[model samples]
Target chain A: MSIDPGMLLAIAMMSAVTYFTRLAGFLLASRLSLRGRARAAIDAIPPAVLFALIAPVVLTHGWPETLAAAAAGIAALRLPLLGVIAIGIAAVVILRALF
Target chain B: MTVQSEYQSSTADEIRQGLADIAPVLVAMVPIGLLFGAICTTKGWAASDVWLMSTLVFSGGAEFAAIGLWKWPIPYLALFVSTALVSARHILMGVSLAPKMHAFKGWRLWAAAWFMTDEAWALGERRARRQTITVAYWFFMAVPVHLVWVASTVTGSMVGPMLGDPAAIGLDFAFTALFIGLIAGFWKGATTAWVLVASGGASALVALTIGEPWNVLAGAAAGIVAAWFTATEPDEPESSSPEGHLL
Candidate 1:
């Protein structure tokens, strides 16, 4: 398929906005030390951010996908990283095909 | 502990250490990159487009959002707005890492910032809390993951057409499974577990109500606020052996 210049432009802008946050963090963090309530919030940010990233995908896709993903995730928790990935992928495929 | 353990010798050495620390995460990351690549390819994106997206945006979630928008042929302004909303977590990531990375200056900080991802931030934050400031360690962690991401995208783009739908083959499960693995690995105690549940539950509720990218923002805001309110005293002893250091 032909690459659209518009799509490329959009991608570049998205990239810039995305990179801005990281750059901002690095630059800003160097200037000040976070502590107290701020530190507490920062500490909590990862799980919150991660959940934000994951929850929507699972919800939009439906419960079956969520359950399957959860099961695969649990399986991944028990196995080696590669094995977990393989099993997770397998579970999704099987569940999709069966359901 | 040996002197080697006491101080990272050089920037290159520190980067190597960081990358070594992040190796286990690649298992989770590779599949995600592959999926993203597959999605882009399936959308009929060329190999160059795939690489450019991966390299430039360097954000799995944002890239996914961009591709989703691409399907609609959304205008560039709308795409940018959606991406910004989706990637709002980066603001939090920036805030969290700011204190720890205060020593870095100019271009070096910029480069490191570019490498920050959810996985990288989790690992980096944990290490920074432990006070591991060797530039090499951070570099090592970020560079390899970045490479794997780009490489997997290339692989996915090339093989994406030939492969059937990821949902058809169950590869989609890898994304959630990887996250679960990450969550489980970091489950230090009840507080952490509760925080996760609250975040997930809140995010889902908001998502069900608000829809699309708004759910992401609402969920994240809810989780952060809940965590802030339920903040625990840092009296508990730090774990000496953090997970993901086996290699």
Candidate 2:
């Protein structure tokens, strides 16, 4: 139990900040009404945010990763979610090895 | 049978389905969790402290950023601000999730928030699209993953930083692959195309130039802007704009 108090405090404060942000959206959404364009915007958020999250690998990583993402996107057209992920990982792994 | 009994039975089924739905993701998370813990230990974080960090913070990006910034003296204020900044997207995610959580009552809703991560929030949104989201279903989906994540950190810390360069074997690609699969769930044709391009392009651009989490914000903002613009068009389905084809 040699845990440093400063380290604990630091992690706690970070957690507090994280928890606050987690709640901030819930509070903000309750305060306002989502309709029309706002609704569309919210709807667009999932795909956008998700794609953006992976943009580093999909776009900047290399042609291999970009190709793998495209292959996975096509597989998404046919396969279920798990299949798409499997194919994507396989595609990236293969493409990286080949290149 | 009474209606109450039927509801109870249905709730059990819902929880089961929730667990089943997240089963693959939970499995996929093992390596990533170990990677996070291992990296932190390499940075000289105590195993107990690493475990606690995962248990309390329960976020991947923010934790990684904090670990990157971890040094002997500890940059307390800097770490706090960076974590807040990295996790700011959660606010938007929460806004998107609020309306969909109709099945959760007051306290249940707040409790559910504690388990809310990007994946959980996204899964909740996806679930809401098809049916109502109950606290039972939500917790079943979110909590197990959270537990696995916490457990992985502890294991990783104890084992120490063993996995070197997850990308060489393509473990790093797992998360990106998973996100692509999840995003596919939200497809909406032309509108989705624009949002994907705008967000992906802006995020990639920013990630290349600036770095880390700011890319998420830029991409999200661009995507939202694209969505707003797309929604403003006349209700009639327009032909794929030449501009879109240009890309």
- Which candidate's TM-score is highest? 2
Every model's DockQ: 0.51, 0.56
Task: List model 2 lDDT by residue over B52-143, tens digit each.
Answer: 89989999889989999999798987898899879888888888787666556677877888888888887887876666677788999999
Q: Where in model 2 is the C-alpha error above 4 Å?
A: B1-9, B232-247
Summing lDDT over every window of 10 consecutive residues in candidate 1 chain B, give the lowest-scoring window. Answer: B238-247
Every candidate's fraction of true contacts kept comes to 0.63, 0.69
The whole-model lDDT of each prediction reads 0.69, 0.80
- The CAPRI category of model 1 is medium
Q: Write down the TM-score of every candidate.
A: 0.80, 0.91
Tens-digit per-residue lDDT, B1-247, candidate 1 = 1112344367776666676667767866776777788888767788888988888888887888878777655578778888888777777787777666644566777887888888888777767645555556767787777889999987888887676665655656666766665555555455566667677777777777876677666766776676667667643432442211211
Stretch of 10 with least lDDT, candidate 2 chain A: A27-36
Every candidate's chain B TM-score: 0.81, 0.88
